[model samples]
Target: MAIIAGSTITASQYIACSEKRDKYGHITSRISGASAKAGHMMRDNVFQTPTHTKEYDAVIIGGGVAGLAAARMLHHRGMNNYRLLELESHTGGNASFGSNKYSAFPLGAHYLPIPNTDNQPLLDMLAEAGILTGYNSNGLPVYNETDLCYDPEERLYIHDRWQEGLIPQLGTTKTTQQELKRWLDEMQQLRAIRGTDGRYAFDIPIANSSVDPAFRELDNINMRTYLQQKGYQSEELYWYLDYCCRDDYGAGIDIISAWAGIHYFASRKGKAANADNSQMLTWPQGNGRLVQHLQQFSKEKTLQQTIVYKVTPQGNRVAIDYYDMRLHTTQRIIAKACILATPQFVTQRLIPGGTYDHDFVYSPWLVANITLDRVPESSGYQLCWDNVIYRGKSLGYVYAQQQQLTQVQPERQVVTYYLPLDHLDPVSSRKYAIALEPQQWVKLITDDLEKVHPGIHEVIRDVDITVWGHGMIRPHTGFITGAARAAAQSSPYKNIFYAHSDLSGVSIFEEAFYHGNKAANALADYCS
Candidate 1:
């Protein structure tokens, strides 16, 4: 089905239609020559009839944690006249889950640490959701003992020995260890220092931090420069830090801001009653289950399947025009308020006509999930919560079946391996990386895993791959505590609002949730 130039339809759209026909054995749309007759014919046959349901007071653009949280908060406030439009068939954009006979497992987001005492709403939400038991004498909330990460929490196979910590130490020389220690000492000092406004230099929620120019200057340089300036140049340390950045921010040290990199280690000040604030709460299904619970609070019928293309302000209401791929329709939703809970890339596309300068950049991620009949035995420590390989571009693997209370049937496990395409130009790298076939991904994961567990490929049963074209947004130099972020929060349209972790310039569950809640509350003020 070759598309003719000057035709009313786009070539890519025609190709997509062809693929659908080939795979599904049906075609309802056509790509004909440009004419009103062709347009009318296509519109009559291809366009999906819009659901003439009652209008919504507000429409949330995403179905991820942020969107769901916004919906949940709005619903709790007795604002049930809202709708959530998600492009995917399922909710929980990144925080998604999958299941088979063995058990349900997380596909993307998996772990969440307890919130700080200051994060009362999050703590309350978790407690209401039965994730917390109670607070201890120190005011830290205790998580369900059963919910804590099991024994053999983490192990790093480095220097031919399985080390107890994620930080590289096995094959490191004295000089490397000393350098690592020195780097940590500097972070500790930064952690202890407070700004002129009596705020912690590296505080969560970002806005609460000090406005000191000296500290804010750290955001001007990339993490690599920051480390280089401090004389912290050890290959092992560099690899470990780079791996950490890739795992969380989806970018390497050079692309990430120094202050943002430091915040990854220093900003978490959460305290728990029976557990340390530093510890995380996770399940085999990842954070997907949490996303599910949040979705339950919203109106399922109001959830539309549409990819928002652009948003235009029309008086007191915002006109949201979106293309529904499934129904092959383009429709508009007018609402008193709107929340753009999408990533920066999508956000940029939506507000192209506006004057918003969001300098946020994002990185791409490639994740491979392998189902094995049995995990290959490791030479160093036994199978732990997270098993990582030494000196690899990838961050090793996580046992997706480990958190199940029910025994894994047939004695098999699933391993989710992650590799961030942290190239100098992530956009181009993502395009090239995405073009690789599934077998290519399987081969990469199998070969990488075989190094630690030899002859393990024979036991593999299935492998699935997911690509985050624009995964986590990077907080480059000057992003954290910058004015661009402040300006982004300002209203672009009278009724439209922006809520995404990307806007915060830091990609974390806390930031995502915080953004959602803030957007919801801010919009709620105009409800009357």
Candidate 2:
């Protein structure tokens, strides 16, 4: 059967491929080999340098959002004798993006939720970046309308038709509808409910969330167990919550903690004069735009393609040894204070035999940018910024050009698709993801899109896929409440600061920014 513009495909006819080739034959992106290159680092041996050495006030590892944020904070505090190192050629890390003749598309992370008023640091950053317009008489922040996600924010493909929102309510029973409403209402109520200690049920940075035993107990069980205990048997509710779990934490509800699942809903307490928590801030390049803004203060201070292999504490100072890929030489850098902004897995490798030997697990993900010569028509709803296929393993796709204010939309557009490879273990996920040649990845995504847009594969001009072996930190049971996570944040030695989203047991922009600034402040006092 030939593919049609608005044709419907039954489950039997839905062709899924582990391997697919781009019918139009387009080139893969520059960042396509990132995962492979990074995979070989541990196995590759580098000669240590004895003669080459440099000193700075501070030296930071990892040029991701956390490192950049820490570097920016140090710069803002008049600390110019500092340097940040990134293993990759770019600074944004997972928030990095790439552009083509079509549009600038994300390689990994995308939108950001509006910050809550209490999140002063984030709000201050937004204000400085001109994203937050100003405060009203109520003191609520007024976000820039241009920065807010445009109308027609999200759409869902369910039962062969597209709906206005991501939730699958079409063809649902009364019980299903009631369960959906009940869950959402309960989440809204819980958002306002505080722990016994006067902390919100959930909060950004996660560290601010209540440590009350009543709430912390939720961290000991998986989300599925919590739902079962609550007597919620609705598959609809389960699918929605599970989708949310995978979307945010990159893991399924069965593996994610109850606290984390709820945090996914209640944690977003963003109240704006112009927008709500549901409203997001996005751009053509995804969160990379925000990363670009954060880099304004630290780009010149950052050295890319330089990997810090080891970090040890010395007399009142810290020592760092790194290998520069471009220079093909090893060098040593010593600083009065040091911030290890790398992930826990990497941190463990650099400085082994630490008390904080936490069992941190990461979820892998696949991000592909599919360029189209001309847009395709959907059966029920028009394409929106975020689009989801109900109950699919994939988180679906985002329109790269959706955030643009072009009166005349271009014929060419790029759709960035996200697929969290969490169905298997990390090792297996990496294996499966790496096994997929470009063609197989094309089939995997286009096949899923074809279920909603019949001929989405035909309009494709190009496809570029990225495999993140350790995409993001998973908030598993015991990760938040257990002492292991906190221990991971401890620095037994002086003048060495620990900073990374993993220290918070979650990987997000806000957490990274929070820990970065917090470490910078700590390092400032220590250095002084």
Candidate 3:
């Protein structure tokens, strides 16, 4: 059917969505589209405030995981005369959640593998948050039983059998299995090997490592080329590697730099007593629980909403100009030091003419949470914590309520599925997302779920599609080299500082926290 742009959509073109379609030929999503457009206008209208208005010791722009972490740390340091400006009403950025009749669930990030034992600060934070109990006989930390993933933790529906791991098994050839084993063994070696400069080849706080160019050169090539050079060619292994890269980094193997790709596997040095290093601590409400704990240290009086327009430095202080959506006024905040924790893309807008030599590549993602009274049972194994269709386009579904492991009212389950829009560039991916209708999105999600569990459509009560247009930046080749870091640090005006995970070229919780902390310290040092 031919649909005209800017014209009232007819009954046939309405594209029915949940409770959006009516007998009167009206589609609620269409109205929602209009509402969303109006919301954007309202948000932009705040920028029209002509005059500057207020002052402070520091102005922190953005309120994502990184921004909030820095805010908490700065607050703890007794810096109360500062303002945290967020475009969104609430904080937590990608770690945000959505609530419905069923329960509150994550829209983006969903889990955190037990962190490295050496990361004492993170361990201390987790303990404070009540996620950690105590150390075992071996000195390994033990997580709260309530937060651990329940039995039937994972399964991959490949070759028509239920496998314990997410890897594709059953109907597999010997060559495929050998290649997979070989790859894993290689990763294990990398995990253990230390650099000549006396640092683990893979460690967090990326700067703490030895300055060895030999291993650093690995960032100059793509993962596909690196694997090819190693003579490890197996279609199944390639697909699995690609899937991992897409799931976490949002980019495919060919696009991600070889160093970053291998680092993904080798960097997770999490050790726990009751759980494996690879195990995750997740909950029904996703990472919202962690965000709540992080917010405990935020300065209550210094947070403002939908403000921050332009920033300029005047000798000793930085002038921050922003618009308040609720008050419909423009205000200014002057601070001794400022931290910008927004994504690189948004950071580009705030800085009028700042240019960095390093290229920042981001991948878009779609996170769907399907609420079901009952998920269709598989033939071989029961419902597991994480389920994936072998070699499928979709990243599969994670049972959000699995951690709690209790029969709650409404008998709800949230299947969080991730799909990376692996487009050539950000512009193309965002355009593709904008083009899809709400019904099309639902169909896109439901069709993929049905592939693994047939007849799942009937059991699902609700479908919430949260599209992260630019989810996480790809750690492509050369992005992590010291040169890239240097390029990112070069400020447009001596006053602005970059503090986004995108600048690090890798999007992990550790990197995000470290990035913010680095920015906070740099700001402090610069002003002092």
Candidate 4:
């Protein structure tokens, strides 16, 4: 089919074998094989007599941000004897990144918004990592200017021209403009609202949010329903909300909960000494830079490419059995306490007879990093850090080297594109995404970009596709305030705990960090 403009050539014809190289690729076949390996181990009751057994004060399963945070907390408490096992060769999980000869680019997560000033723990971590150099005399965070996103932060292609911001301005009706203003006013009021119990209506870390039924009731309905009830009928407004939801939650307003959708706007109340709340700290490798800071806590004792298939709680200790992909052998670890930093799906498999509620739905996603000879030419405004196409199928692309300070720019640049596969259900989306090849992904991405940058295929140097089968947890109706989440956070065994962004029903960096610290503190107290 003819996907590009002004040309009768098919998408396949545009992408030749010599023009594309699939580097830093992650196919879902490996995930399927890993699942099969775990299933077989459970079905056959094969423990595979461990090659060696080691004991630790605590053992963490999954070396993602949550696991890394847990490790850091344990280290802070002076508990040195711990181990972290990760299924992937790298430890960043969804925040992973890859590098080419020209520049480094994000594979999944990319930016972190400026955090609320009240979040002391997060601020302290950032301070330790040197992102937050120190506090000013007014007690506000003084972030490193270099790490903050540079000018020309965001732009949107609308009405055949690029605008200075992502919001719909050109071609928008007067009614749409009024509705947008009303929506912004409502969100600002919501940001200042406090529950009777003295907590913000919507707060980061999610656990700190007010629990009043007034605000919590929003979780019972989808964001689309809430918007309709509020008398918002602007097509442009709906599209913007849908884009925001998909960018953060991997779902649209129709699928995500009203509370989650609102949180995306109201929860960010960060006050900074230099940068504004809307400003974000980013790097060429995206959040992978933050991951590197967290990885230091577990680097010495982490076992990458090791999958923990089973976790059995004995009378006093937990027995963990894992397969080391590199060594090609099974091993056992006995720990006084354990933290399962894995997602609910993997957690269910690790602990036999443990079944998660059906509300826990994960969305599949596709992320591609395309390298080009130079930035693609666009009309209206110049290329920004974030370039969005209004009413496009994807979340647009981010200029990977936007944070660079060098006077002379590199001839080659990489732009990372994100697409949440929300058209079908999660199961169907995963099946569809895994079946696609690199060339298919390249076509899908280039076709989307062709709307703004005509003949964009000519400057392309390479395309890398990473498919996340269970990308992020979807905050569907009632899932955020449901009993399932509360139950999942608590452990039946004294020495076992849980930590992951999935527990929060909205996957983000701050929530993952919060849960990790929460689980680590609980485990440390029990061990003490």
Candidate 5:
């Protein structure tokens, strides 16, 4: 359909999502064509204030993972004179969840890696969630067996059969196998190498990575250039590495930074007495459970459906102007300190001389949840938590309820399919994504799945599609160690602070949580 006239969508086609739900969670009959219009309005909204005003010690805008973390930290410090404002009716930003009678599934992010030994905030969150029981005599943490992924952790569809893991070496030449092994061994060696500063060359949250000029210079070039310079020409290896780039950065390897590319492999140092770095921690509802835990503060104090459009320094306080969509009133808040915990794109638009204008590039993504009456049997392995195709453009689906522990399998199942729009520029990709009709998406999704599961098309009952215009930031060449990234960590104003995953040059649960905690500590010192 074309862009509906007059921003607000009262049209029948867009409103049919409510009609499609069957006594369970609401289903998306279409790919939210209304979001494009709504998003434009949000960006283009003008700022003004009515007669209403409120006072608080701090005010947090944008209730995503970062905002929630800041709020939770502030509450833990006994700072209750604060409020959180969210643009959506619900919280959790990308870490949202949905449910039906059969199961609950993730809407965006699905899992978290085992925390590195240096990442204290992440480990604390996991321990509070009951996933981390205690430490062993070796000083390594012990994980709850239930939270760790069960047997048959992963499988890949290739060579007309399912393999035990995602690596595709079932039918390659001996030369290709040797090359792949060489790459794996190199990664292992790099993982253990430390810098002159006694720090691992690359570690979680990216900030703790070694600052040695030898390694830091890797950010000056793209991953493709780095790979080609190393005399690595294995097509299979490139395909696998390219898949990793698309899965994490939502961009092609040619455009992603070499430092970010290698960091994807070396930064993960998660270890446990019971689980290895390769093991993951996940739930049926994904990171939404973590979002809920962070939001365990005063609900009555929060202001949902609120848009913050302006932030200006007012003497020793920061003046925040926002409009509440639910109340249809514009209000003002004079906060002693402020945390703009929003995406880079949104934050840049909210204030003057905004950071990240020249260095940040956010990616666009597509996620479709497929609800099936019965999962059709495939030719290879029965089923695994994560299923990937050897050379496919889209990352294969994840079994949504794979963590459910029922002795007997349920009659129905759900799988979430992910696709990154990297074939074009971000602006063009978002336009093309929103213009696609529901039937067009259905055809595309079915065609992608039919490669492995022959009859999956017939078993699919419902398909809900969610499109993210600015999904996550891409760490392009010269970004990770550049001046723009370093300068973005602090705000121009003394009383106003900034926090978001984009500031870290990469988007992930660990980085966002760490960024929020760091910002909270900085702002807390000044709040008193």
Candidate 6:
């Protein structure tokens, strides 16, 4: 459309430009790697008998972080006779990335917060990946300088101009300022407080959190309700809290459990020699870099483009029936133990007649990687790693190449835009997002960007979209501490184990890694 300042683009031109493929010949559309049709076929009980059968000591169904972690744990335990199956051609699940000629960008998950010092397993993994270089004299781990997020970390477009940080401080009233201070003070106390059980009141992996009922009861109400009960009444505070919920849980304060929302603030207690807890580890390609490290452990044993439709427990073994997308054939694997690392929604279809009644509500998300010929001009602050627009429809965009160490910034820049479809229910939102046309998505994105960066359309070179129907698990009221979650975590059969972030009621890398490792440990114990 070649939109310039003070000029509007025609709908036809917008459609034309939006449909234009990137340098890699990839168009702006929903990611096509997932096996949605195969999932439907599995749901409909449309199965073909396997023409071939194989045997393995263990079988990991799904190739996301959870599954990959399971594979790594199995190898760590000296179990080499195992196979990992993935529906997509590539692994990483939500941590996947895509690239064009200019830069590589994230498809879904983009960053990892510093791991809590108590999370030794995660620390070990990061150390192995060289992200955690070594410990300092004071015992705090030192991270790789290049891997840490660079300077100009965050900024927010508020009061018609970019501010230093995301907090709406530029135009905030005294009441809002006081409320924000109170919230921060309370969160700081909560961050240091431990329960009577001697565990942190809130911790990553969620299971490691204190089991005190006083804190556990927070899961019985929504975050908004919690704020109201505490006499918090600031519009800015409410908006900022809602934004935080949407950024992490893919939902808002009204929908997320108070425990989860508070955990978002209080749980991050990671101390590093070089970076603070607020600092995050990121790359141009996002968490895909971590995935690359994890993939090495499962490289020779992982099978891509394979859909495991059915998993059943035999007398002393587990039978896994899978369909090969490339070969158009079905195969069977008999294993002594099996780990179903898929989400609960997909796991239900794989194992028919399961009695576990889970109330898992996943939030849908839309992520777009926009390639621009030049950086869009803005007021108040220069482009930062994470740039957010106050009260914007989407979470705003991240400067993808902010981690680049080159003195001369590239002429071409890529920014990943994130939008959680939480205006409606998850089902309706998913449908609405999937039904959006390429041009409609382009308009939605460009319209939002124009609000902060006027005439940004003129600089845009390409836009690639990825929609995650079941993006991440949401911890609703009572879901985290409910019986359904407990049942979902248990193994119905002796030879089968469940492992996914959904079981933790919060979809984050640490929980997924924990569950995967937990499942592998259980399987190893069973085999012994």
**Predicted structure with the largest lDDT when compared to the true one:** 6
lDDT computed for candidate 5: 0.80
Which parts of model 6 have CA positions greater than 4 angstroms off?
1-33, 355-358
**lDDT (tens digit, per residue) of candidate 6 on 149-235:** 998999999989998888889978898899999999999999998999999999997998999998999999999999999999988
- Top candidate on TM-score is 6
The alpha-carbon RMSD values of the candidates against the true structure, listed in the order shown, are 8.1, 4.4, 4.5, 4.1, 5.0, 4.1
Local accuracy of candidate 3 as per-residue lDDT tens digits, 1-528: 212111233445444543343322121122011123423443354465446567676778887778877777676566667777777667777787766666678778887878889878678778888999999999999999777767778888887667778766677789888888989999999888888888888776565544577788898899999999999888878888888888889878888888888888888788989997788888877787777788776648445456555667777777777777677777777778788897665565556564534377767777778777777778777888888878777778887767665566456667787777774466667666666766666656666777777777666666677777667877877788846565675466666676877766778777777777777766666655
The residue-level lDDT of candidate 4 at 299 comes to 96
Following a full C-alpha superposition, what root-mean-square deviation does model 3 have from the true structure?
Answer: 4.5
Candidate 6 RMSD to the correct structure = 4.1
Q: Compared with the true structure, what per-residue lDDT tens digits does model 1 show for residues 172-255?
A: 799999999988887778876888888888877776677787778888899899888988879988888878777788877887
In order, candidate lDDTs are 0.72, 0.81, 0.72, 0.85, 0.80, 0.86
* Of candidates 4 and 3, the better by lDDT: 4
| Model 6 TM-score on a 0 to 1 scale | 0.94
- Which residue runs does candidate 1 get wrong by more than 4 Å? 1-54, 299-302, 355-358, 407-410, 481-484
Please list all clashing residue pairs in model 4, or write none if there are none.
Answer: none
Instruction: Show the colliding residue pairs in model 2.
Output: 19-440, 20-439, 20-440
Each prediction's TM-score versus the true structure: 0.86, 0.93, 0.89, 0.93, 0.92, 0.94
The lowest-lDDT stretch of 10 consecutive residues in candidate 5 is 1-10
Q: What is the lDDT of candidate 1?
A: 0.72
TM-score of 5: 0.92
